[model samples]
Target: MKKTVKLTVNGTTYERDVEPRTLLVHFLRDELGLTGTHIGCDTSQCGACTVSVNGQSLKSCTAFAVQLQGAEVMTIEGLAKEGELHPIQQGFWEMHGLQCGYCTPGMIMQSVQLLDRNPNPTEEEIRRGIEGNLCRCTGYQNIVKSIQWAAQHKNQGQTEIPEASAPKVDPQPIAPVP
Candidate 1:
């Protein structure tokens, strides 16, 4: 039997009839046209398909669409507001954190969750928080730097915002490690 589900994604509401076995990631990407959420692995091992359901970071691949009833889903697309990029997205861009860009969306989504929980995350905290999202680009140096930059920018709000929808790096700021 098909079920009707209502998903509030990226500040938009979508209602659809789907099977019980439909994966949330597939529903988001294929059904809702929210392609920003990518699925790296179906085993829930990689955090590439991560999303925030009601403000908690989770692996979308392992979740069923039916389970998310009445849940407010926040994907990477919903991170920014009024053309402003999320600080996390800016962190990756300015730090040159991405290479192939496969894991970026998930990283940004997870970063939002991290920031929502702790706006200012330390290097170790950031690393531990994003341990699930794997990136084989830039050797993760830029990724760490990106997160650090976003933390400082979000806290201060002094950083120039090029893309309001997704923050870009500020010339790749290299902070001094104390």
Candidate 2:
């Protein structure tokens, strides 16, 4: 059955009829044409399709579009305003947090929520914060550094963003669990 859903996304209101089985990720990508939210693992194991629904970061692939009635959704495309990148996005760019760029959008979204809950997270905390998101390219060292850079500059409005640099060598890749 086709169900009508009304939701706000990126400060824009959208009301459309979607399939009951439609996932939010599909709704955003197919209906609304917001393709920045990538679909990695449809089973929600990967955080590539993460989005902010009512200020909480979640895997969009697991969430039905009908379930988001009257909800506010924020995708990666909404993060920047007036041509200025969100600190997290800027951090990703400056820190070289992404390569191949498949996972950048979801990583940034999750990082935003992570910083919201804990603005000053340690390296371990940052790692744990983004444990759900997977990046196949550019090991997580740069991602961690990117989040750290964002944390350092959070709430500092209009200030010049400093260059992000990690002095230490990149760590060895972690072996996958069997």
Winning model by TM-score: 2
Which window of 10 residues has the lowest lDDT sum in candidate 1? 161-170
Each model's lDDT: 0.84, 0.89
**Runs in model 1 with CA error above 4 Å?**
162-178
Candidate 2 lDDT (Cα, 0 to 1): 0.89
Model 1 agreement with the true structure over 1-178: per-residue lDDT tens digits: 9999997998888899999999999999899888888888778887889999998989999999999999999998887777766778777777778999999989888888888788878888888888898887666667887888888888887656555635444575655533
TM-score of each: 0.87, 0.89
Candidate 1: lDDT of 87?
Answer: 74
